[model samples]
Target: MTKVKVENLTKIFGKKQQQQVALQMVKEKKSKTDIVKETGATVGVYDVNFDVKEGEIFVIMGLSGSGKSTLIRLINRIIEPTSGDIYIDGQDIAKLDKEELREVRRHKMSMVFQNFGLFPHRTILENTEYGLEIRGVEKEERQQRAEKALENSGLLTFKDQYPDQLSGGMQQRVGLARALANDPEILLMDEAFSALDPLIRREMQDELIELQDKVKKTIIFITHDLNEALRIGDRIALMKDGQIMQIGTGEEILTNPANDYVREFVEDVDRSKVLTAQNIMVPAITTNLDIDGPNVALQRMRSEEVSMLVAVNKKRELLGTITADAAAEARKNKQTLHDVLDKNIITVEKDMLISDIFPLIYDSPTPLAVVDNEDNDRLLGVVIRGSVIEALAETTDENEVMDNE
Candidate 1:
């Protein structure tokens, strides 16, 4: 189910007259610079539309001045929109009164900012329960909830410590726990890890991933880093000049970029780390174990023009593999295909990253078999060296062209 839906959302900054003129200019398809020059107004977000599904991480990403921060602020009505609708689970929050909005922010959504916004004067536990405290939750119940959130954030032992007494990463964990203490249905994180050192940032990212697995809250994460978006987002919206350029899964955006701008953003990304066996694998060439004998196996191999053929049972469960040479030898010796089957073939799970399959591909004489891990090791497809090379090379060439232009 869609947890949030934004349609034709816009936010303009300037005088009322200039904002109205800028909004008109946006509808007329005028460039942002031209609109600003003509009307003396800045478009924070213009006609941006997207949806966030329940319990999924929806990342909004762009370079500085791209209005990513503004777009996120509009979602929670922390910054009111100039036009359009912001729906949270079918309610148009854009029209909500002050009290209604406050209740929404209190119970349905919570925000975590870039600057670890923890109270310096308060203990970590107290800081965590601050939201609940303001909402008039009973002291004992709020404390219990705060302690649970802190434990979940891996900051339980540090609950007694103040913000200044902890590392930057620990302080950020407190901010996360604070957000969790309210048990909001949605999390709005605006560059929550951007302030940390690289190592600490990665650790926080990992922790968030683990935390999400446990809590399953719908997260709307804002970031300027494409890699971070690709790593954490279930889907990503790439923005520029207050408009959404494209929205898709990481693999979709990488392999089939919407435009040259997106191509440029992904040019330097390591495709091996992003691409997986399932992304490039072709259908497995196989022969049935019960029905097909050595002669039939050889014929199948000849027809497919492959050196080896995978053998499967009636249910398509992988039994073994047979080489052309083995099949021919078995046929000559009047033996069944199973008698010459080789069970030592290299295999990779369908979800295994291409980088992880390099060693297996290098050592295997034939293409690496891709199997469904959730299934009974059923053969899904095969990933040849050529296929892997071609997938990576194609993106590189496209990216280089984009960069040159």
Candidate 2:
């Protein structure tokens, strides 16, 4: 189910008199520069539309002035849109009254900002319970909730300490704990980790991933870093010039860019780190254990023009692998294929990164088998050396073209 849906959401900034003119100029396909020159109005966001699913980390990413921040603000109605609709849980928030909007912010969604936003005077526990206090929750109940959130965030030990005493990452965790204390259904994080040092930023990213596995809250994360987005987002929306260039999973954005702009944005990314065995593997050729003999295996390899063939039982469970040379020798000896099976076949899970498989591929003579983690290690496909090279080479060529352009 869609938790949030935005339709034709547009935000224009300037004098009220010029807002309509700026919107008209946008409708006429005028450039932002021309629109600003003619109407003295800036378009913060333009005709944006997308949905956040029930429990997904939907990242909105772009460079400075991309209006990603504005889009987030619009979702919670922190900034009113000049024109459009913002729907949450099938209700149009744009049409909500002041009291209803307040309830939505108080109970349904919580935001985390880049600044950490922890109060200097308040203890970590006090800061975390602030939201519940504002809602007039009982002191004991709120305290319990806040402590639980702090524990989940690994900040319970420092609950009595002030924000000044903690590191930047810990302060951010306090802000996250505060958000979670309300048990909000959706999380709006705007550059929440961008202010931290690189090492700390990575730690926080891992923490969020681990937290999400347990909490499964619907998260709308905003960031300027492509690598961070690729690491954390289930799906990402690439924005530019107050518009979205593309929206897709990390692998899709890297492997199949929507246009020149997106291609350029991801051209510099490390493909070996993002591309996985599932992305490069081709279907494996195989012979059956129930009926196929050594001659059948050799014949299959020759017809497929491959050096090796995988062996599977009646249930498609991977038994092992057999090479044409081994199969031919076994046929001459009149032995069953299982007698000469190469049980020690190299295999990698579907999600294993190409970088992690480089050494394994180098040491193995035959293509590495890609197997499903469940289903009794069923053979899914084969990852040949050429396939890995080709995947990397294609991205390199694309990047070089982008550099040339």
Candidate 3:
């Protein structure tokens, strides 16, 4: 379902005369006035539209002053829009009165800024609990929730320390915990990790992904960094001069550039990191033998020393996987491995995260498995982690050429 919708949104700054001053310069071929007017009546955002899916991390990216930040601010009503409708969960919030808007901000959404925004006088626990406290949550309930948020954000150990006592990365986690403690459905982030060191930023990005895996809240993240957008966003919305130039998945934007602007943005992307198991898995194989007995399956397991065995129907298409225990159970029951084998499987479809393989890397004696798309369950290929890492290394080398060029 669409969690948020922005339609024909535009935000223009300055007064009427400032706009005219700029327009008049164009007619007279006046360089000085043209520059003045363009700067004076700048359009922060113009006629933009898009929808954010529930539980999606939708990113808005552009160069500074490209209206990326302004667009984000408008969605949250941090700044009133020049004109357009902003909808959250099918309700048009643009026309909401102050009290209604405040309610929305308090209950439905929470934000994290570029700076940590921690309170100097409060300890980390107090800082994290501030939002819940403001919403009039019971002190005990809010404190317990804050502790969980802090633990998830990796700030539990520092809960008793002041913000100044922790590193920048730790403080940002506090900021995240504070935002998360409200149990919001949508998270609005404005360059939330940009102020950190590169290594710290990378760590925070990974942490954000982990959090998303667990919670799946809809997120609207604003940034000027293309790499950051690709790493964290489920879908990216690239903006230029107050307009969205393109919106698509990271791989889509990388493999099929929408225009020169987007092409330039992704010119140096390392493709392998963006690729998933579906891109390289082998075709599924089928075999028909009445070895459904547990003794036969145990023999196969001992012979192969495999962690799991794939079970298929007559066509060799995937049905599910069975582990060693099932084979033993089948033997005890005087049944074939086929009889006791499980057909339900937790397989990755193409476009699944490369990181998804982390669990599977050490999961079986065989390094390869049938790949499927998580969205459609369509088979893709068989993949091994070694090949993925090699592909990433090759992509890194390829990216270096563009950097030097």
Model 3 lDDT per residue over 231-299, tens place: 999999998877788999888887788999898888776676676776556544322334355555556
lDDT of 3 at 148: 95
TM-score of each: 0.91, 0.92, 0.75
Error of 1 at 228 (Å): 0.8
Candidate 2's C-alpha lDDT?
0.92
The CA root-mean-square deviation of candidate 3, after full C-alpha superposition on the true structure, stands at 7.3
Determine which window of 10 residues in candidate 3 has minimal summed lDDT: 282-291
Query: Relative to the unseen true structure, what is the C-alpha lDDT of residue 394 in candidate 1, on a scale of 0 to 100?
Result: 74
lDDT of 1 by residue, 177-268 (tens): 99999999999999999999989998999999999999999999999998889888889999988999899988899889999988878778
**lDDT scores for all predictions?**
0.91, 0.92, 0.79
Model 1 quality (TM-score): 0.91
Estimate the overall C-alpha local distance difference test score of candidate 3.
0.79
What's model 3's lDDT at 243?
A: 75
Clashes of 3: 19
